[model samples]
Target: MNKELEHRFVTELENNQNIVHKICTLYTNDKSSHNDLFQEITIQLWKAYPKFRGDAKFSTWMYRVALNTAITLYRKSKKRIQTQDYDSVIYKIKTDDYDDTEEQQLKLMYDAVKQLGDIDKALVFLYLEDKNYSEISETLGITEVNARVKMNRVKNKLRTILNP
Candidate 1:
């Protein structure tokens, strides 16, 4: 890659690493699997970077790549197991806008969201990341009205998980 393209890719990756991490967390519970997923997402993003036109926001495009990569990327191992236990892995981190309770709540929310089916988890992830209905629809290849309906259902599902 040329220097300019390399720099742009690095800058974009730095800006969007959290989204990759969020996807990684949604896909697996083990630290090794998380790291593997993160690397896979990063590799997929880099591969897809060359095709990114200026039609959408960089973050929006990045979200699509990450989601597609998460959904379609192949893993060699078949023995990996899914676990729903986030209680032992939960932690609170400081954010500019969140208090301790909010931080904890966010972590717990991710835990609950992680328990959702793959597609629904992707819906909730995009929603939490502040993607509008149109962006979510484009990313998931669904209609805008379907996006709205699915998002509403996912929200209610999350509310039940968070409040119960």
Candidate 2:
């Protein structure tokens, strides 16, 4: 890549590293695995950056690549994620926005989300991130209706997990 393209890619990746870390956290059980997955996603992003067009927002384009990288590696793994350090993975939730009860509920919800299948977990994560159905569809390569329907099913699944 040229200097300008390299510079741009680094800048964008730096700005969006949190997105990659979040995906890594979702997919991996331990800090070691999380770091590995993050590096893999970054490498994949850098390799594919040349083909990225200006058609969509950089972050929007990133979701597709990052999610795919996580899912693909997840499928290739032999063992399930054993355990996640909830404190380590969950950086923080402010007291102003959420009380103790709400924070506990959020942690429970995250645990439930972790039980979902890989694709379902990705779907739920994107939905929780406030992505619209259109963006979710585009990111996951499904139709808008499919994204909405899957989201409804995911919500029901989470409810069952949390309430039972």
Candidate 3:
């Protein structure tokens, strides 16, 4: 990439690195996996940066690229391991600021979220981030109607998991 483009990409990426972190946290269960996925997403973003047309917000474009990377490129090499009901593996990175009750509830929610399939998890993540139907549709390449429907289903699924 040329200097101007590189500078722009770095500045934007630095400013919006939280998008990458959120995606990584949702997709990876452990620190090693999280770091690996983060690195992978960053590489993919760098490669695709030249194609970004700036027709959308930089953060919006970053969401699409990061979600695509998490869903498609990053995968665990080991056979999946069975985990406990409230797995702490994923929550290890969380700060101790949350009291025990809050932490337990959060862990349960995270565990429930982990049960969702990749695409559904992406939808849930977007919903939790307060992304509207249009933004979620654009990011995931679904129609707005489909995004709304899918988000409803995801919400229902989460409720079932949390309540059951």
lDDT of each: 0.80, 0.87, 0.85
Off by more than 4 A, model 2: 79-103
In order of listing, the candidates' clash counts read 0, 0, 0
Residue-level error in angstroms, candidate 1, position 146: 0.6
Clashing pairs in 3: none
Error of 1 at 42 (Å): 0.9
Q: State which candidate has the highest lDDT.
A: 2
lDDT of 2 at 36: 94
Report the error of model 3 at residue 99, Å. 1.8
Model 2 accuracy (lDDT, Cα): 0.87
Stretches off by above 4 angstroms in model 3 are 74-98
* 2 versus 3: better lDDT goes to: 2
Candidate 1 lDDT, 1-164, residue by residue in tens? 78899899999899879998888877776777778888888888888888888698888888888877776642333345545456556885657975578768777887898767667888988987888888899888899999999888888888898888
lDDT of 1 at 68: 73
TM-score of each predicted structure versus truth: 0.77, 0.84, 0.84
* lDDT by residue (tens digit), candidate 3, 1-164: 69999999999999999889988878777777788899999999999999999999999999999988898854453356734334443456646775578768877887898788888988888888898889999989999999989888999999999988
